[model samples]
Target: MIRKSRVVLLVLAAVAAGVLLTAGFNVSPIARALLGDKEKPALIPAAAGLRMVPVDIPQLFKEVSPAVVNISTTQLMKFNHPQMRNPFGRQDPFDEFFNNFFGRMPKEQKRRSLGSGFIVSPDGYILTNNHVVEKADEVTVTLLDKEEFKAKVVGTDPKIDIALIKIETKKKLAYVALGDSDKLEVGEWVVAIGNPFGLGHTVTAGIVGAKGRIIGSGPYDDFIQTDASINPGNSGGPLFNLKGDVVGINTAIIQGGQGIGFATPIQLAKSVLDQLKDKGKVTRGWLGVYIQALTPETAESLGISGRRGALVSDVTSGGPAEKAGIRSGDVIVRFNGKEIGDEHELPQAVASTKPGKTVEVRLLRGGKETTVAVTIAEMGGELGKPAGGHDLSKNLGLTVQEITPEIAQRFDIENTKGVIVSGVEDGSPAEDAGFNVGDIIRQIDRRPVSNIAEFTKSAAKFKAGKTTLFLVERGEARILLTVKNK
Candidate 1:
């Protein structure tokens, strides 16, 4: 009986102790989730080895936004009929209504494309693309500080797709300095600040995907390709290096692709800007040669190990190359001491060179390397003889002309050759006959017509709706043609 009474006393004491312990501390949900009915204390979180500090992108925007200018163009275009126009492009019903009501409507289309530009000089000089201001009737410059000024087009080079402009403002405009684009490495961090989608001061971050990408934008296409999100209004904005210098001019992008964009290297822009500011016009060197890319078949035929370098299809008579003894079938391997990688690279190297400067041209002839010095001549000047004109133009859009003694000697054509038609009109009768320019006419209708008069008589028969046979000479080769008048 005493033992039972003692057990009851102990059980009551245990219950009281349990109640006191439960009152002292409650189990956290986190601890209860892991330990279930057995309540336990939660453990304190330990600090990680390293923590990434949050970056202040707004600081970058504030630093570079002052140097970037918002370029808005106003062009006077005469629109005839449509009341509400959709110039921005094909959009749905809402886009059409937005343009019709809010945007430039049925009135004369003073169509203008809004883009971005950056001041490269403290003196108010700016750099942009040629397409941005090419046909701009009036260009208005607006700053990030809400100031506007009229800008003048200083100089433009459409070939390289760069332009220089000056704004008449003495308000101490903020400008970005040009960086050395030649020293930029792939995967370097780049920031593009521009007004994209008409949104004000949009800045995007990316890395340079590649350098010297040929996007077929122009003759000189050594553009820096980036995965930067360049869009509609980012055309002329400054692509900044991490040092806050302008490394490139944000120019183009792949429309449907994400993050594929291109820019004009600041190095090329600097040279063009200097020339544009001083000379008002760009004078490019002329090599006077029609070149084509070497294909695999051409490489096999030439017994070349690799299909590279520009192939001289035709050399202009009395041009800089011809003056230096450069001839047809010669492959230009090097120009001005730089190796020619392909056909397009040759043009850029040649055109960028100064006129009247002698350049070393290394060419491959008969599997032998030949060296020649060519003094570049001015382009677009009228010479005494018709340089590109062939009698091909006169005879129904087919330019054909007698190969002069000089041309025959230059191109290595036989002196006793008939007038050659160099090009034929597409869908024209000559195209059906498979007649191309550079085909030397040797005989007509099986009758030997050496001179122009005899050739004219045979050609006249074809004019009266008759088929005429022609024996054409094509580079130490001959081809027969039976073309009937259509």
Candidate 2:
């Protein structure tokens, strides 16, 4: 019986050994089965084809640091000294002698600032923020090799905060390749090279936190948010992707906020690069329309299904939009075949388009889609205001009068055919509707109100508890306001 039991044990041991070999030398499966343990699959499977590729950050920095540069600027600030006048209004002879000897107490002082930039061309055309070299009397660029060269300001766009500068160099310089910022995905790693705290050629690494961020810096506020340790001297530095391509320009940082930095996308810089190179400034296309975002409530009121377009609040008189038959209340869905996702998108799209190019504008009017061709116009200077006039609509708490020649001259108004708002009573319907003094009432409920008589006639037609649309010309822009009659 002992011999038989040994034979059976030997056979079981052989079977267990065979099982372990078949299971890729894993003894845990057999041991678990012997212990009556249940098996569980891995939470993350190895067969999912996911692999980690280590990045050589040092190698990348070495390759791209040659194109990065440190910028130093000097500006002269002059201050006028308050003159010590005699109580009897008599000139003191001693003051002139003191000023001549002391050189007017050093009226001017040199203000020096430091920033960063990157080379974009072989001939040494560098790109940096406008604020860096905006009012500087002198700008100097220093390369990684410690070679310095005086730079000339080629062009500057203050609205977008980009500046193009050039340095005279006989030798070809290294430049960074511009990448498509629109393709940069969130959470992807990015590298920033700049002169942070005057430490030239400083490099930092982080992932993109967000894109298309608006910090209210200017009209064009689209920025790439990153945590790449950008500082005051890092302004106008280059933000690079893994491929060593320039993706963004480091431009802003939140005060006292850790790891919060903003960059201007390379795409925006590219859009105006040629213009900046050739014309020394950027000329933007204008639509002459005041637009607002289509809110859910506004969309529903307009019988629209989705809030995906820009609601036109007003159209500028004699502007490109008005000439194209685009009216107030129209929702702009697309511009030049590009989809306008919101009100902000429309402005950027329109401004990027070359002026004098006629583009198709797709819009929704009263629940119906339509398209119009508009010839783009160059954006002009500011518009003039209108002077106050006599009272016309007392019930609406508005004081308006006809636009007279004297009033037009006083206010610099070119058009003298509309009714100008003189005053608005507090807490009244007109005041609540944003009726301001100097607003020229051109139309009421789609009817022309050329003068105070016409405005009075139109005001009498307002129904109690009903909303009425008013088209007013304020400065150079036109606006649409709605007032509920009480």
Candidate 1 matches the true fold with a TM-score of 0.65
Q: Per-residue lDDT for 186 in model 1?
A: 95
Error of 2 at 312 (Å): 3.4
- After the best TM-score superposition of candidate 1, give how far the Cα of residue 474 lies from its true spot, in angstroms: 15
- The lDDT of each candidate is 0.74, 0.85
lDDT of 1 by residue, 82-144 (tens): 344357654457656766676754556687788899988788998888888889999988889
Worst lDDT run of 10 residues, candidate 2, spans 37-46
Show model 2 residue runs off by greater than 4 Å: 1-55, 79-104, 255-258, 295-305, 316-318, 379-410, 421-432
Model 1 residue 336 CA deviation in Å: 1.4
TM-scores of the models, in the given order? 0.65, 0.77
Query: On a 0 to 100 scale, what is the lDDT of residue 302 in model 1?
Result: 49
Tens digits of per-residue lDDT, candidate 2, 1-486, equal: 999999999999999887666454454533443444334211121244452221455777898899999999999999886555577877676666667787546789999999999999999999999999999999999999999999999999999999999999899999999999999999877889999999778989888999999998987889999988898899999999878899999999999999889999999999999999999999999988887767664565466779888888777767888889998778999999999889888989999988999999999988999999999999866522322117556668889987888999999988787799898999999998889999988878767778877887788888887777777888766666777788
RMSD of each: 17.1, 8.6
